[model samples]
Target: MKSDMTKGNIAPILIKFMIPLFIGNLFQQFYNMVDTLIVSRFVGADAMAAVGATGTIMFLILGFANGLATGFTVLTSQSYGARDENRLRHSVANAIILAVIVTVITTFISVVSMKGILRIMNTPDNIFDYSYAYIITIAYGICASVFYNLGASILRAIGNSKVPLYFLMLSAGLNIVLDLVCIVGLDLKTFGAALATVVSQGISAILCFVYIYKKQHSIWPEKRDWHLEARDTSHQLRVGIPMALQFAITASGTMIMQAAINLYGSVAVASFSAASKLQSLITQGMPSIGQTMAAYAGQNFGAGKYDRLKGGVKNALIIMTVYSVVAAILSTSLLEPAMYLFFGSAENVAIQLPWAIPYIRFCAICYIPLSAIFIFRNMMQGCGFGFLPMMGGVVELVSRAIMAALSMKFMIYELASACDPAAWLTTGIFTFVAWLYVAPKIERMFSGRQKVID
Candidate 1:
């Protein structure tokens, strides 16, 4: 809502902003992918599988928290655009207070239920220890994750994407260093990866707050700014809860999928994990444009610049759609080489390569429609229609459940029929199904409201 991403020379400005965001997000995935890469290379495929084991659960809780913060970011951006300093300050204070409580509660819940959560997912017997250790270690540091996201969202809200990107860059470098040292030098194994991530996130969060306090003129919060009314907190939760819940539901669906993956045995688990790691390397940049669109939509909508808001959405679609197609093409052509680089053992590589090819190709296509969903959610959230994003989440959850169930049945069918293509087909079919559900909704959101957004 702060920077007018829609107003400038569209091509040049989009390139400038989105490039940094794209690079930063790619590096962010590097923090994650490094774990799988190093562990698979060093600790054995089982250890890598252990790291993979935590993914859906981690995405579940972490996604919800980040989504909640993003909602606050959109709100703060609009408040700042309207030059309502008091509301911005209030938003910041309340966000901090709320995030702290949620972090603590989530930490307690996650830690206490770590084993149960893993059990529900039917995480492979061999990798259970690594999963538990990783989950517990990260949950213990949930406070750091919360702070980092809250701070980053604050920076983005006030049009300081570069600042958070800078902090994340710093954190990513630190993460790489720590990951290597922890696993290789310290021999902390899976725990080391979680520790490295937590420590890096904490440092970034702390640095972010310091930066916000000193330099963000519109966002500086005084002691008196800390008091929050129940209604306002509820209001933030109202806007934020659905976002958080959306992630939770998606994660739950993924957890089911994770259980299904585990049913396929260690080779299947390891192969799927390798592909997920590699694909994230390409697809993670979608959020940058999504967030950019959200900011543009929020600022203009707040200023009642409806025409610009409409134009901005069109601009975002053009930008993200092109990238998604390119990503799909690259993934299809390069899937084998990428697998060779990231995975291990002749058997492991062979098992993973085929599965990755079809899954990523489908993802590339999904990215096309999916990008529109992200842009629309952010746009809707920016326009103060926060609940639309929640509806999207529900759609995602339902589609995901259907996809996973069908995929599993397909997997079982393949087993019985001696059809090896079942796994890859399951993936491609699900990817298409997701896009099918998501694309129609995005088209509907803008079909009648085709006023150009700023």
Candidate 2:
């Protein structure tokens, strides 16, 4: 169902909207987490590391697409809030066109660079072939991932987060079934896991596309809405490129961190990979909150309800803070069992637990700062304060790069683990400061409008 967040009780509406998003993100992460689970448990730790090895590169490519899709949806949300169906319709169509263009380019580049990227990251020889097989297979289906991300993002922008959750649940189930069939039954190994992910995502993308094509409502476009408006395209790129750069910048930092992690050899890689997956599962709440804040901020900003937007930010911060605490507790509890699940309970594999535990704990501790960064940065983006978020991205990049360099130079792999919290803390500070600077200006702008109307 469609929602008008512009006038509702801020906290309830935001919570209701975010719950499905939170669930959907869990299922979405499961698409890969399942792959890792099945591959590690059924195949081996090396296989798990192979899948894990692809994470940063995939993040670099798919993260950019997701960010672009998210940036495009800000326009849709604002338009929906303003009840400007024309703008919403045009933005949707143009955004789809842009997604198609970007998907093609990204897929091509990723496929071509897969092996080279793995080599540059210094993928260990034992896992190199497995990593190549997994990533190349994933690269082949990049369009599916990008399409689903764009389609789902557009839906949420219009206050229909539930539909995407339904789609993801379906896709995730299918992925698990395929994982069993391919990895267990057929014993297809790493390639099978990657193929399962692509095919499942493709199904979700197709389903989402069909739904939007047929809906023809407020945010969905009809035949008449299919034309490309140069103005809309320009606006999309203007907003989207910065967001995309922000994601790419952040991913590049992770890429650096991954390279640093790779220097430690396969055991370290496998442990880090497994631990990273668990942390990702725990930290889903941060992104869910950010996404909810984005929609809330966009809608209220477009409706010129600056105070409502502020209220949404405050409520979202509370939500994220509570979630961060819960996540830290859960992560600390599960980190051990999760490692056993991934690397096996075998005696030889037990040695990796010592290395993995500290990294996972560090990540869990960092969730608090991460929550602040995600909420503030995404809120800024949704309110169309694009530059601040972009600057926050820059902060993230610099902090991680610096930390990773120091860690690698000193051979303190644990210090490499500290990079995440450091980046989150620095970027959170920047975004918080930016919000402080900008909130008053927005209030003044709207205050003048209210006075004129009076």
Candidate 3:
């Protein structure tokens, strides 16, 4: 299961690695999508809106956890590529230590701040309690999310994407079953949905840990691996904190946009929420490819295959560009129908569709820039240039803040809809430029080292 990305034809290997990652990503998204669908259908539209309202905040906290876990794995991947088994084991062990600390911090902050965040977003009085219950429950489950991401990330770091995908698939199915049992059978509503997600992810995390312990001997930590060195911790934090902050910053922008949307009341919030879910589903492939590039670039960079890394980036761009076009067509064509999946009542669908459709279409049309953001930014992260990507996230936060402010000032719902595409455009351009500047320096540095060796 441990494959080497540094030695294959660029496009085929990338695609092969990418397909499982894309599918796994889809299944991961399904956890939330299913929660929304079950909550909307059984508990009512208000309940669905409550769950939806929590989306950005969930992204803020949980995204930081996942991003940190991923950043930890970059070192693992590099160690794998360089054939440093000792370093890989140490990286994995240190990552676990950091993840535990992060889990405790993230869970406490998110749970304690949950209600205040909702108030800041101006959540409607109608759904305030439902939103609070749902998100706070999710906040309590941060450990599950963090460890699952950490485990899956380690598997992917060594070119073993399939095991994580298999476990994710199993957990996703369990999530649906548990959603129904709790939401419908037990009548738990939004709280139940959050609980189901947490439990399912916890199971996945446990399974991944078991697999690594039993099967992945190459990089598995021995007794000595547990002796954490300051250097190893520093290395993980150097990449992890910037990566985590990048996600947190982007989510902060989303929180800003959500606050502006909240000004329009629950109807707009519900519409945007439903549309956003559909868009995430449709464009899952972009991020999947981005993740693929991370591993691909990380491995090659570690192996000193700078030319191959460049080739992989080029191939990844081509793949993402083509996928973006298809995703656009799918979003515009399928979005209206997809709304029904969340809202069973025709009246509710009618109320939300008019507001939701344009937003989905606008984002769909601008998928290229969004796609570019994922590809280039992740490639940079994989290559150990984490700071610029974090700066790109800052650019995104500023763009969304500006748009959200404008939307609120003028009461134009349309401007709020434009926030995402605007952020994507600005962030995408910034990251691409950063890549251009960084890629040359990397190549030149490695080339000179090779010359010195010669």
Candidate 4:
């Protein structure tokens, strides 16, 4: 069901909305982690390395598509919060048109360039084929992933996060079954994992499209609204292009980091892969709160409720800090068992744990700063302060790139582990600066409102 977030208690609403989003993100991460889990255990370490090798590439390509879709939703969220039904419909229609364009362009470019991209990442010869197989399979299915992201973002924009969560649960469950069948039963290996993801995403996308078109009347576009206007399209691109570039820019840093890890050979690659997967599993709450803040801030911003917007941010930081401490504790306790589970042997554990454990520890304890970066950055994006957050992405890119380059000089793996924290710290500072700058401007909007009344 569609709910309006323009009114009501901000904290409770944010928590309620964030729970579903957090769970939904869990399923989404589970969707990817399952692939690595199955591949590592069933297919051998090389296969796991192959899958890991494509991680940054997938982020680079799919990240851009997902970013564009996410950017488009901000406009829809603002329109929904303001109760401008006409503008909401047009925003949805234009977003759909834009998604189509992005899907085609991204799929073609990523699929054709997969080999060269892998080479640039310094993927070792032994694992190159496995990585290529996985990347190509997923590349072909890029449209499915892009569509699902667009559909889900739109749903969340209208305060309908529950439906997307439901769909995601279904997709995650289905992908696991397929992973078992394809990777374990049929022995399709890396290709199988990628294929499972694509098929599951396609089903989720279809469900989202059906529900939005047939069920949700509030934000559905009519035939007349389907006609895209140059000005509106420009407006979306204005908001969306930066959002897209932000993700691409951030992914570039990760890609650089991955490239550095690649130079350490497959042992390092596989270790990083398993550790990163585990990190993603535990750290879902960080991004979930950030996403919830985005929607909450968007609605409050649209309604000219600047005070409520600040409340949302304050509550989110409190929640984020508490969760960060809890997650760090849990991660420290479970890190070893999780590693053993992922690799499944004392021998494999011995090899991977050295690199994986310290990296996870560095990341786990640093969640406070990490959470700040995501919340403040996304809050700005929600308030339609897209450019500053985009600049935060730039800060992430530069910081991570510097660390990745510097990690090459150090023999200690902790240097590499420190990269993310450094990036998060700098990015958090950038985002706070952005929030400080944007807050005054937003306050001035309310000032204008009071003057109008006077």
Candidate 5:
């Protein structure tokens, strides 16, 4: 476990580690995809659309929680790499503690804000109750989501990637079964979808925490460590806040796009939402690499293995580029079936197909650049280039604003119909805007890194 950070063939090592991470991520996301599948197949299109309707808002709230856990993962990876057992335990303990805090706050806000947030997304009046009920149910389990994330991250840091993956597979399987029973067999509808999601997540989280408590030597804490040290809390907050807010900013921006899509009605909403669920599978690809990079970079950086960090990034870029191209080819070929899978067989895939296809195809192209942004940022954060990562986060937040301000009017003038040209615009041009914003900042950081070495 310890050797993964500093030794072994870097490329194969990363790929081997990330395969499970990717599979786990796929399964993790598969939990919801299964629901979308079952819902589209049996519960009817409007119900499926109702569930999809809340995705952006979910990202807004869930993304913030994820960003904070990301910070904790960085700290843990670094501590583990340094082989500083004391620091490792401290970070792990605090990560769990921090997860509890963020979870409670987010769950509260999500529940309270569910209806307004849905309304602001301009969800049609008919879908409003379903969105509210689904979101609130999903929010009830935010703590579980964080529990799984934080614990799984710790496992990854210490090179136990497979355990988390196993847990995710088990829980996701449970989710599929429950989803089938709720939405397919019993006819529970949107609220059933939400229940399935939360229960699945809760199962995974509880088992992971219990196993860590009982088994993992890496996470054991002394009584004194229970209360977080001042420096630890301060650093976690400093780093976590920007990371969390980056997601918040991006998620909030997405919420705006969701509002616009809603104005087009349930079909447009269904198309966008269905494509999004399908697209989630693709985005998880390189991000699996980015995550592995996070642990690899952080652990190496903390141990001062600077050369390994350099090698890891080079390998990451090569792999991500190849993947982007391959995914583009596959998505282009599978476009019809993929959309058909989410929208169901009976429905005319044509209605949603064109909409899902272009947006996903655009993603396949932008994915590399987006991944380039992630690799550098994850490395920078892992290395505790604290303020620089935050600066990059600022770039992402600002670019979304820039993209929206400039693009909406043009989109209104252009496609301007139920066809959803905005999907391409939202995920594509907006992403390019962010890439432009981040590129120069990342270049400056590396330039400074070179200076420090010289």
Candidate 6:
């Protein structure tokens, strides 16, 4: 089931690897959107906005854990590329240990600090309790999010994207059913949506772990593999910490933007939330291609296939450019209908459309830079250059913070909406520039002309 990216036609291999990733990503987003739809319809707009308001803080905490899991896999992907079974198994073991440590720490911190963090985000009075209930429940289930991401990242590392897709599809279906049962049947409201997400993710994690146990015996850790070594642990943390910081830093910027949005009241929050989800669904291709590049570049880099690495990046850019155009077209075309679907009523749509439509359209036209952010950032990470992407995250944070600050001062909806585009543009340029600096050094290291430390 493991497809090696170090062989075969570059475009076809990448495309084949990318399809499952895209579909899996789509279903993941679909279920998330379902959460919002059900919440809005059954619990009302304020409830939907309450869930939405927790978005950035959740991203800040959960994104950090997910990022660490992803960074841990870079080494796994590399070991797989080098055909180092012993090292690959060690990497997997260390990753599991690290994931456990992270889960405990993040869960405790996030759960304890949930209410204060929501308050800091300027959550409106009407939705404050709802936000607390939703996010706190999600925080309690952080292990589910962490383990699922770790499992999926490990699968992708070994070039087996299909298995995770299958489990995720199962998770999505279960989530929809649970969302209805928890929200409507049990009258749990926002907490039900969060609980459904956590439980579904937990199921996917268990299934993914089982699959890896049964099928990936070659890379599975033995008793010896579980004995942690300082060098291996250090290596994993070197990549994982920076990657986690990158996600945390970027989420902080969004947290700032969310604060700005909160000032605009519940309607703006709900509209922005709905529009953002729609954009994410439409633009799934960008991240999918980025993830493909991560594995592709990781495997090729491990194999010392510099030309193939370069070729993969080139091919990815072409694919992403074409996909970005298609995504932009789809976002613009689907705006009205998508808004209607999210709110489930024309009356709600009429109120939110004026704010949501332009925001989505603006983001659609800026997909190229957004595409660049994903491709180059993941390419760098895949190539064992984690620090560069973390710096790129700083660039994103600064851009969003400045935009959010300006939006707050001016009291303008347009400025608030501009936060994402601005951050993408800035971070995209930074990552591409970082790549130019790192690529030559990678080639030199491969050529034995220079020594590079990852």
lDDT of 4 by residue, 1-454 (tens): 7777878877788889888988999888877888898998898899999898798889888889989988888889988888888999999999999999989998988878888889888899999999999999989998898999899889989888899999999999999999999999999999999999999999999999899988897678889988777866887888788888989998988898888888888998898888888788788999888888888888878888888888878888888899999988887788788888778889978988887877787787688988998889888888877798888889998988888888777755667666777788888888887898899999998789879989
Q: Which TM-score value belongs to model 3? A: 0.98
TM-scores of the models, in the given order?
A: 0.88, 0.96, 0.98, 0.97, 0.88, 0.98
Assess each prediction's global lDDT (C-alpha) against the native: 0.72, 0.85, 0.90, 0.87, 0.72, 0.91
Residue 48 CA displacement from its true place in model 2, Å: 0.9
The TM-score, computed over Cα atoms with residue i paired to residue i, of candidate 4 is 0.97
Q: Residue 291 in candidate 4 has what lDDT?
A: 82
Better of 2 and 3 by TM-score: 3
Ranking by TM-score: 3, 6, 4, 2, 5, 1
Candidate 3 residue runs with Cα over 4 Å from true position: none
Which one wins on lDDT? 6
For lDDT, candidate 4 versus 5, the one ahead is 4
- Judged by lDDT against the true structure, how good is candidate 4? 0.87
- Write the residue-wise lDDT of candidate 6 on 1-454 in tens digits: 8989998899999999999999999999999999999999999999999999999998998999999989988999999999999899999998999899899999999988888899889999999989999999999999999999999999999999999999999999999999999999999999999999999999999998999999998888989888667988888888888889999999999999899999999999999999989898989998899889999988998898899988888888899899999999988888899988877778978999888876887688789999998888888899888899999999999999999899899898788888888898888888889989999988987988324433
- The deviation in Å at residue 410 for candidate 4 is 3.8
What's the CA error at residue 154 for candidate 3, in Å? 0.4
Give candidate 4 regions above 4 Å deviation. 449-454
Stretch of 10 with least lDDT, candidate 1: 413-422
Candidate 3: what lDDT? 0.90
